[model samples]
Target: MKQWKLGLVVVLGISGLFSGRAIAAEEIILRYGILERTVAVSDLSQLAETGEATSQLQSYFDTAEVPAEEVQNMLNSDVTVDGVNINRILDNPLGDVLLDEVSKSIYPESGSAGRQAMRAALVLSAVDDDRITVIEVLENYPTSRVVLDTERLAETYEDFQEVGGVVVTVEDTLDDVLNVIRILETLSN
Candidate 1:
């Protein structure tokens, strides 16, 4: 039988992302080395909805050296994933690894809380429309201030690309383990 339940969850906890409501983030603090800038979450929402970049949001693209078009693609690119499966994947050790990588870029102001915050952002974002996007993640960021490191986004992007692989891998592992347990129980019986 297929393990359809393995598709979901992390620090802050996989449970936290799927359950409690997080305070919506107000602004995103874009950081690159010693330089830092802030863009209101509303600004991002407008851009995602209309494809128009406000001056403040455009400034961040210029400072981060990330192409505006590419960032926009990221902002709106939607990945369809079931909520329960996403929660399961994010709650595991491998999920923590993915969280750690992403949190490096998009996290709370405190920085240390990046892992859990990232988990919540992704889960809540996915919860919104049965899909998740970069903009959705930012909108659901579980803090007043969300930080994005423009320099570190490449790895985060790569990790996101692997979400499909992670889901498949987790399900396979669960099936294998469950099969072994069944065989061992049969032998004992």
Candidate 2:
């Protein structure tokens, strides 16, 4: 009888974790080029969380100018045990292009999912310069600090350097909001 009771409790606990409204609302803002857009941060339960979404999200990070290995770990990670999502900040036209491409690629599987990711990416673009300058991609990383030394990642550097841009990542685990701002700061002196 004791074993039965314990089993029931475990089952109930597991079910409770899975059973919940899929729609999660969050407050966030993104700026791309000179346009700033405000949007609610939430995950669509209807979409059903899947590895494909994780893979797609990773693709953006993979193609980025930063270290591929580090980026991969970050995107495919659920660092926060509390169910909080990490935020990534990518700077410049490349960042904008990445979001656009992501939206286009994911349109068939899920329009809403693509839009949400793009919207999130756009929120990070705090500048509307139209020209590709600096691209800072900051993510809300988990407690575990992952060192992605940009200097070490040469192949990736070659890919991004062709376009002339750099991505700086900042990790803030506690913050519920993953906000990133890419500013042109100054023109070539």
Residue 95 error, candidate 2, Å: 3.0
Candidate 2 residue runs with Cα over 4 Å from true position? 1-21, 24-93, 104-116, 121-165, 169-189
Q: For residues 1-189, write the lDDT of model 2, one tens digit per residue.
A: 345434533543354347441211232232223433332222111112232223433343344433434433433322111111111333345555644543342221223444343333233222222122112222211101112222333333344344222332222422323322222223322
What is candidate 1's lDDT per residue for 91-111, written digit by digit as tens? 888888888888888887876
Which ranges of candidate 1 are over 4 A from the true structure? 1-22, 63-65, 172-189
TM-score of 1: 0.73
Number of colliding residue pairs in each model: 14, 19
Candidate 1, which ten residues in sequence have the lowest lDDT sum?
A: 1-10
* Candidate No. with top TM-score: 1
The stretch of ten residues in a row with the least summed lDDT in candidate 2 is 78-87
